[model samples]
Target chain A: MSTSAAERAVNYVILIVFAAFALAPIVTVLAAALSPQSGAESAGLAGLHPGNFVDAWSEGEFSRYLRTSVLVAVTVVSVAVIASILSGFAFGTMRFGGSRVLFYLFLLGIMVPAEAIVVPLFYDLREVGLTNTLWAVALPQIAQSIAFGTYWMRAYFRTSPPSLIEAATLDGASPRRVLWSILVPIGRPAVMTLTVLAFMWTWNEFLIPLVMSPNGDFRTAPLALAIFKGQHVQATALLAAAAVLVALPVVIVYLFAQRHFIRGMLEGAVRE
Target chain B: MRHQRRYLPYLYLTPALLLFGTFLLYPLVRSAQFSLFSWDGLGASEFVGFDNYVELFTDEVLRAAFGHALVLILFFSVLPLGLGLVIAAILNRGQVRGLGLFRTVVFLPQVLAMVVVAVAWRQIYAPNGTLNTALRAVGLDELTRTWLGDYTWTLPAVGMVGTWVQTGLVTVLLLAGMGRVPRDLFEAARLDGAGAVREFFAITLPSVRGEIAVALTLTIVAALKTFDLVYVTTGGGPGNSTTVPAYEVFQRAFREGAVGSAAAIAIALTAIIFVLNVIVNRIAEGREE
Candidate 1:
C-alpha cells in the first residue's frame, strides 16, 4: 500500500489540471469585473482593472439588491430552521397513526420540482395581495426548504439516543423544553449546515423572484444582475463586475463552511 | 402506553402536516383544476375540460421544448456523470494533496447563482470572447463558432455549462461513496495481481453504484427541469432552439397569457418527473435486493 514516486507525481499533475479547469470561469469573471473598459468589445484578459468594480457597484443598484437578497435569505433560513427543528423533532421522536404516510407525503415536495407549482403559486400570492412583497418569495422558499430540512433533521434526531429524550421527560422537562434543551443543542452542526444551505439556495434563487416581482424596486441581487446584463448589454466589464458582486457572498459563505455544505448536501443525497 | 406514545408523535407532526396540506398538497390540486380552465391568471377561469391537455399534445412549440429538455439531459446528466466519475476516481486514489482546495474549486460553480453562471459562460462563448481568443491563439480558429448562438450547438453548449456547474457535485458525492469502500478489498485485489484499472472496475465501481444512481437521478431531474440557465444565456433564442418545458411554461403563462395551457405543460412535466423518479427508485431498490 506504499505510494510510488511516479504515482504521486501523476496524481499532482491530474489534480492541478482539474482544479484549473474548475476554477477558470470564476477567475475569469472576477478578472473581467476588474477590467476598466465597459463595452461589448473583446477585453482579451488585458482590460481588467479595479475601476470597473466601482462602476458596476454604483451603476447597477447592487447595494439595494444585496440588501434585499440578504433579507430574503436570512429570513428564509431562520424560519426554515425553526420550522424544520420543530417538525423534524416531531417526526423523529413522536409516534402517531399515519405518521409514516404523512412523512412520505411531505417527501413529494422534494420530488415535485418547484417550477411545476410556480404558476399556481404566483396566482395564489397575487390573489392574496402579497405579490411584489418579500414574503411572497420568502414564504414559498421556506415551504420548499422544509421538506429537505425536515428530512435532514429527522435523520439526525432519529440517530440521537432516545434515552436523552426520556431522561428529559423524567426530569419533568416540558416537551418544548426537551426539544430546546435536549435536541437543538445536540443538533447544532446539522442545524448550521441546513442554515448555510438554505441561505445559499434562497440567495441564489432566480425564477421565483423574477416572475413574482417584475418591478425594478423589489428585485433580488440575482434578478437585478440578470436585468443589469440585459440593460447594459454592451458593457461586458460592468456585467462581469455585477456578476462578481452578486456571487461574492455565496463564495465567502462556501469558503468558510465548505465542509459543512458539502457534508450536508452529500448526506441529503445518500439518505434520499 | 404504546398508544399514548403513538399519539404523541402525531401531535408533534401537526405543524408539518398543516403546512404540507396548505402549501404543497393544495397548490398541486389547484394546479390540476386550473389546467382544465382558461384564465389569464387574473380573470375568470373558464373550465374547458381536457382541451388544454389535448392542445398541449398537438402544440409544436411544446413538443420542441420537451425535445430540447431531452437534449439538455444529455449535456447536464450524461456528461457530468461520466466526467465527474473520472474525476472522483482520480481524487479517490488517495495520492492527491490539497484535497480540500480541489473540492472547493470544483464545487464553486454550484454555489454561484445560475444567473451568474449563465452570464459568465455567455461572455466566454460570445463571438470574440475569451474562448474564441484561446481557440485562435492555439491555432484552432477554424473550429471557433458562436457557441451559444449556433442552433445545433446551442442546446448542448448550454448544457455543457450545466455540466461544468454540476460535475463538482457529482464528484463530491462519488468521493464520499468511494470513501465507504474498504481499503482492504482494494488491497486484496492488488495482491491478486489486478492492475489499478482492473481494481477500479472490479472493486471501486461496484461499491459506489448507489452513489452513481443517486447522482444520475438528481442530475437528470435537474436537467429535465432546466430553465434559469437557458433563460439567462439564450432566452430560448435563435428561433426557440433552446426552449425547454420550464421555459415554455414561463412563456405560456406570462408571455402568451395562456395560463391553462401552461398549467397543462406543468402537469405533463410533473408526470414525466414522477415516472422517472419511480423508475429510478425501483431500479435502486432492485439493485439493493
Candidate 2:
C-alpha cells in the first residue's frame, strides 16, 4: 500500500481535475443565476446580481409547488414509515403463512417503474373522481415508498434481539407498544435512513405528479419547473435561478446528512 | 382466544397489503390487461388480442427509443465505470489530499434533483453556454454547437449528463469495494516488482468484481428508466432524436391516447429492465464459482 510522494501528487492532480469537471457546470449555473442576462457570455462574471432569483420566484410562483411538495413528502413519509415498521416487525418476528410470497409481491413494486402502472392508474383514479388531486399523487407514492421501506425496515427488524421483545411482552406491553416503545427506538438509524430516502424519492418524484396531478393546483416543484421552463425557455438567467431554488432544499438536506444518504444508497444498491 | 395469536401477523400485514394491492398490484395487472385492448381510456373498450404487442415490435420509433437508451448505457454505465475505476484507483491507492472533499464534490450532482440537473445542463449546452465559451477562449471554437438541440448529438449530449451524474456514484461505490481488498495482496504484488498498473489489474480490479456488477446494475437501471431528465430537458424533441422508452410511453398514453400500445411499450421496457437486473445479479453472484 506504500507509494512514492510523486505518485501521490499525480493522483491528487487527476483527482482535482476530475473533481473540477464534476463541479464546473454547477458553478457556471450558479454564476449565471447571479449574473444579469444583459451581459454577454464574454462579459466574464461582470455585472453579477441576485435579482434573477427575485424575478424567478415572483414569476415562477414556486411557493405553491413547495407547499404541495412538503405536504406530499410528509404524508408519504409518516404513512409509509409506520406501515413498513409494523409489517417489517411482523415479518421479522413471526412465522406467518404466505409471508415470503407476500414480501416478494411487494418487492415487485420496486422493480416496476412508474411508467408501467401510471397509464392505467390514471383511469382508475379518474373513475373514482380522485385525479388532479394531491391524494392521487400521495396514494401511489405511499405504496411505492412502503414497497422499499418495508424491505429496509424488515432487514433491521430481523436483526433486533429476541430478548428485547420478550422483555417487553413480559412487562405486559401491547404488541404495538412493544414496537413503538422498544424496537422503533432501537432502530432509529435505520428508520432515519429510510425516512430521508422516502422523503427524497417522493419529493423529487416527477412522473407521478406529471401524470396524476396535471392541474397546477396540486403540482409539485419539479413539475412546475418543467412547465415553467417550457413557457420561458428563453429566460436563461431566470431559469438558472429557478433551478437553484428548486435544488436548494435537497442540497441543504444532503449537507446535513450526507453520510446517511450515501450509506443508504450503497446498501440499497445490493438489494436493488 | 389463544388461537387468535395466529392471526397477529396477518393483522400487522393488513395495512401494507391493502395499500400495496390497491395501488401496486392492481394497477400492474390492469396495464397487462389494457395492453390487449384498444380503448381510449374513457370510451368503450375493444379487445384487440395482442395487436398492441405486435405493433410495439414493428414500430420504428419505439425501436429507436430503445436503441437510444442502449447508447445511453455507454455514457451512463460504461464511460462512468471506466472513469470511476481510474479515479477510485487514484483515491484509494494512495493518501490523497482532501479525499473526502473531492468525493463530496464529485457526488454532489447525484444528490441534486434530476430536474435541477437537467435545467443546469440545459444552460451549459446552450449556444453561448460555458462549454462554448471555454472553447472560444481556447481557440477551439469550431467544436462548439447547441449540444442538446442537434439531432445527431442530442442523445449523446443527454447521455453525457447521465455520465456526469453517475460517475461519482460509481466511483464512491468502487472505492468502498476497493477498501475491502486484502492489504497483503497489494504489498506482496508490489514486492514482486509488479508496477502500479499491473497491481491494479492483478489485485484491485479482480477483487472488486462484485462492486463493479452492482455499479453496472444501478447505473444501467438509471439509464433505462430515465424519464424526468429527458422530460425536463429535451421532451423527446429535435425530431424524436432524444426519445426513450419511458418518454415514449408517456407520450403514447397521455398525449396521443394510444393506450394499448403505450401499455405494451411500458411492459416491454419493464421486461427489459427486469431481465437486465436478473442478468446483472447473476454476474454479481456468479463469483462464487
Candidate 3:
C-alpha cells in the first residue's frame, strides 16, 4: 500500500481538481443563496451571508411544497417496501407456477420510462377523477419503486439462509409472522438500501408531478422549484435560495444514509 | 384441497401487480393504441392508423431532438468514461488522501434534483455568470459569451452538465470494481517496471469491464431521457437547438396537443433506451468470458 511521495501528491492534485469541478457550481449556489445581495453578479464567498433562505421559505411557499414531497415519498416508500418484501419473499422462497413471468411483469415498471406512459396516464387519471390527487403521484411511484424494490429484496431473500424461515414455520408461525419476526430483521440491510433509494428517487421525481399534478397545488419540491424559477428569472439570489430549499431534503437525507444509498445504487447498478 | 393453498404466491404478489397493472402496464398498452390515433386527450377521436408513427420518422425537428440526445452520449458516456477512469485510477492509488470526502462531494449531484442542478448551472452559464466572470478574470474576455444562449455551444453546454452529474457515478462504480483487483497483481506489475498508466490498463481496466458497461448504460439512459435538465435550463431554447426526445414528448403532447405524434416519439425513444440497455447488457455479458 505504499507509493512514492510524488505519486501520492499527484493523486491528491487530481482528486482536488475533480473535486473543485464537481463542487464549484453547487458551492456557487450556496454562496448565491446566502448572499445578501439580490441577483448578485459574482459567484463567490465574498458576498455570502444568510436571510435569503428565510425569504425563499416564506415567499416561495416551500413549506407546503416540502410537505407534499414528504407525503408522496413516505407513502410510496411504505407501500412499495411492504409490497416488495411480501412479493420478494414469495418469489425467493416458494416454487410457484408463473412466478418468473409475473416477476418479469413487475420489472416492466422499471423498463418503460415514466415519460412514455405519463401523457396517457394523465388522461387515465382524469378519467377516474384521480388527477391532481396525491395518489396520482404516490401510486405510480410506488409501482416503480416496487419494481426495483422487489428486484433488490428478492436478491437478498434468495441469497439469505432458508433455515430461519424453516425454523419460524416449524414453530407454528404464519408467513406474515415469519416475515415480520425473522426475515424483516435479517433483511434490514436490503430494506435500508431500498428505503433510501425509494425516498431519493421519489423525492427528486419531477416528470410525474409535472404531468400528473398539473394543478401546481399538489406538486413536489422539484416541481415547485421549476415553477418558482419562471417567476424569479431575474432574481438569481432568490432562485438560488429556492433551489437550495428544494435540494436540501435529499442532500440532508443522503448525508445521513449515505452508506446505504451509495451501496444500494452501486450494487443495483451492477445487477442491472 | 391441500393444493389450493398454492394461491399464496399469487396473493402475496397482488398488491405490486395491481399497482403496476393499473399505473404502468395499462398505460404502456394504451399509449401504443393512442399512438395510432389523433386524440387531444379529452374528447373522442378517430383512429388515424400508423400516420403518427410515420411522422415520428419524417419530422425534422423530432429527428434532430433525437439526434441531439445521441450526440449527448459522447458527453454523458464517452467523456465521462475517460474522465472517470482517470479519477478512479487516482483514487485507487495506494494511500490516497481524503478519499471519502472526495467521493461524497463528487456524488452530490446524483442525489440532487436535476432542477437544482439546472438552476445552478444556468447561473454559471449566464451572460454575466461565473463562467464569464472567470474568463474575464483570466484575461480571456473575448471568449466569454452567454453559454446557454449560444446555439453552437448550447448542446455541449447542456451535455457538460450531464457529464458533471455522471462522472461521479462512473468513477465510483469503476473504483468499486478496481477494489476487487488483487493488490499483488499491481505489486508484480510495478516490480516489472510498469508505470501507473500501464498498471491501469494491465490490471484495473480488464477488471472493471462489467462496470464500464453498467456506467455506459446508466449515463446513456440519462442522456436520452433527459427532460428535467432541458426543461429547466433552456426550455429547449435559444431556438430548437437543445430540444431532446423527452422534452419533445412533453411539448407535443401537452403544449401542442399532438398526442399521437408525441406518443409515436415516446415509443421510439423508449425503444432506443431499451435497445441500448439490452445491448450493453449483452456486451457486458459477452466480455465476462
Candidate 4:
C-alpha cells in the first residue's frame, strides 16, 4: 500500500482536477450572485453587489415560498420519524401475521418513483379538496419518507440489543413504554440521520409541490426559484442570486450536519 | 391482555399504513386503473384497454424520451462510475490530505435541489452565459452555441448536468467501500509485483462490487426520475430533444390533458426502474458468488 512520491503527487493532481470540475458551476453561480445585476449576459465577477439577493428575494416572493418549504419539511420530518419509529419497532422486534407482506408493502414506497403516483395522487387529493394546500404536498412526502424511514429504523432496531429490551420488559414495562423510554433515547444517531435526510428530501422536492400547487399558493423555494427563472430570464445576476437564496438553507444545514448526512446516505447505499 | 398483545403490532403500524395506503399504494393502483381508460382528468371516460400502453411503443416522442433516458445512463451512471472509481482509487491509495474538504465540495451538488442545479446550469449554458463566455475567451468562438437549445447538443447538455450531480455520490460511495477493503490484500498484491492497474482490478474492483451496484441503481433511478431538471432547464424545449419520460408524464397529464397516456408512461417508468435495479442487484450478487 506504500505510495511513491511521484504517484502521490499524481493522485493529488487528479483529485484537485475533479474537485475543480465539481466546483466550477457552483462558483460561477456564486460569483454571479455577488456581481452587479445585469441583463442576460453573466456579469462575470465585476463589482460586488449584495442587493441582488434582496431584489430577487422580494420580487420572487421567496420568503413566502421558503416559509412554505420550511413548514412542509418540518411537518413531514416530525410525523414521518414518529410513525417510522412505531412501525420500525413493531417490525424489527415483534413477530406478527402478514409482517412479511406488510414490510414488502412499505418497501414499495421506496421502490416506486414519485412520477408514478403523483398524477393519481393529485386527482385523489383534489377529490378530497386537499389539492393546492400545503398539506397536499406534506402528506404524500410524509408517506414516502415514512417508507424509507421505516426501512431505515427497522434496520437500526433489528440490531438493537435484545438484553436491553428484555431488561425493560421484565421490570413490567409496556412495549410502548419500552420504546419511548428506552430505545428511542439510545437510537439518537439513527434518528438524527433520518431527520436530516427527511428534511433534505422534503425541502428539495419539486414534483410534489409543482403538482399540488397549481395556483402557486404553496410553492416551495425550489419551485418558486424555477418559476422565477422563467420570469427573470433577462436578469442573470438576479436569477443567480435567487438560485443561491434557494440553495442557502440546505447548504447551511449540510455544512453543520455533513457527517450525519454523508454517513446515513452511504450506509443507505450499503444496506441496499 | 392477550387480545391487546395480538393486535399490538397492527396498532403500532396503523399510522404508517394509513399514510402509505392513501398516498402510495392506492395511487399506484389508481394509476394502473387510470391507464386503462381514456379519461382526460375532467371527464367520464370509456375504457381504452391498453391503447395507452401501446402508444408507449408506437409514439415517437414517448419512445424517444425513454431512449434519451437510456442514453443518459451513460453520462449519469456509467461515466460517473468510471470517474468515481479512478478518483476513489487514487484517494484511497494516496491517503490524501484534505479529503474531507474535497468530498464536501464535490457532494454539494447532490444536496442542492435539482431546481437549484438546473438554474445554475441554465446560466452556465446560456447564449452569453459562462460556457459561451469561456469558449469565446479561449478563442473557440466557433465551438460556442446555445448549448441547451441546440437539438443535437441539448440531450448531452442536460445529461452532463446529471453527470455533475451524480459523480460526487458515486465517488463517495466507492471511497467508503474501498476504505473497508483490507490493506493487506493490496500489500500482498504489491508483493506479487502487481502494478497499480493490476492491483485495482485484482483487489479494489472485486471488493467494491456491492457498492458499485448500489451506486448504479441510485444514479440510474435518478436519471429516470429527471423531471425537475428537464422542466427547469429546457422545458423539454427548442424541440422534444431533451424531453424525458418523467417530464413527458407531466406534459401529457397536466399540459396536454392526456391523463391516460401519462399514467401509462408513469407505470412503464416504474416497471423499468424496478426491473433494472433487480437486474443490477442480481448481477452484483451473481458476481459476489
Worst 10 residues of 4 chain A by lDDT: A38-47
**Candidate 2 clashing pairs?**
none
DockQ of candidate 4 is: 0.73
Worst 10 residues of 4 chain B by lDDT: B1-10
lDDT of 2 by residue, B167-260 (tens): 9999999998998988888889988999889989999999989899889988998999999999888989899898999998899888898898
Which is better, 2 or 4, measured by DockQ?
4
Q: How accurate locally is residue B118 in candidate 4, as Cα lDDT from 0 to 100? A: 92
lDDT of 2 by residue, A191-229 (tens): 999888888888788899889976667898888888788
Total backbone collisions for each predicted model = 6, 0, 0, 0
Residue-by-residue lDDT tens digits, candidate 3, A152-223: 888888887878777777777888787788888978988999999999999999899998888776888999
Runs in model 2 deviating more than 4 A are: A39-47, B1-4
Candidate 3, residue A77: how far the Cα is off, in Å: 1.3
lDDT of 3 at B285: 89
What is the TM-score of each predicted model, taking all chains together? Answer: 0.95, 0.96, 0.96, 0.97
| Model 2 chain B: worst 10 consecutive residues (lDDT sum) | B1-10
What are the runs in model 1 whose C-alpha is more than 4 Å off?
A39-48, B1-11
List runs of model 3 lying over 4 Å from the truth.
A39-48, B1-4
Q: Report the backbone clash tally of model 3.
A: 0
lDDT of 4 by residue, A1-272 (tens): 57889988998898899999999999999988888775434444355778788889999998899999899988999999999999999999888999999998888678899999999988888998999997898988999999999999999999999899888787888998889999999999999999999999999999999999899888899999988988988888889999999999889999999998898887765434
- Model 4, B100-213: lDDT tens digits are 999898888999999899988988999989999999999999999989889899999999999999999999989989999988988898899998899899999999998999
- Clash pairs detected, candidate 3: none
Second chain alone, TM-score for each candidate: 0.92, 0.95, 0.95, 0.97
Q: What value does the lDDT take at residue B143 in candidate 2?
A: 95
Better of 3 and 4 by lDDT: 4
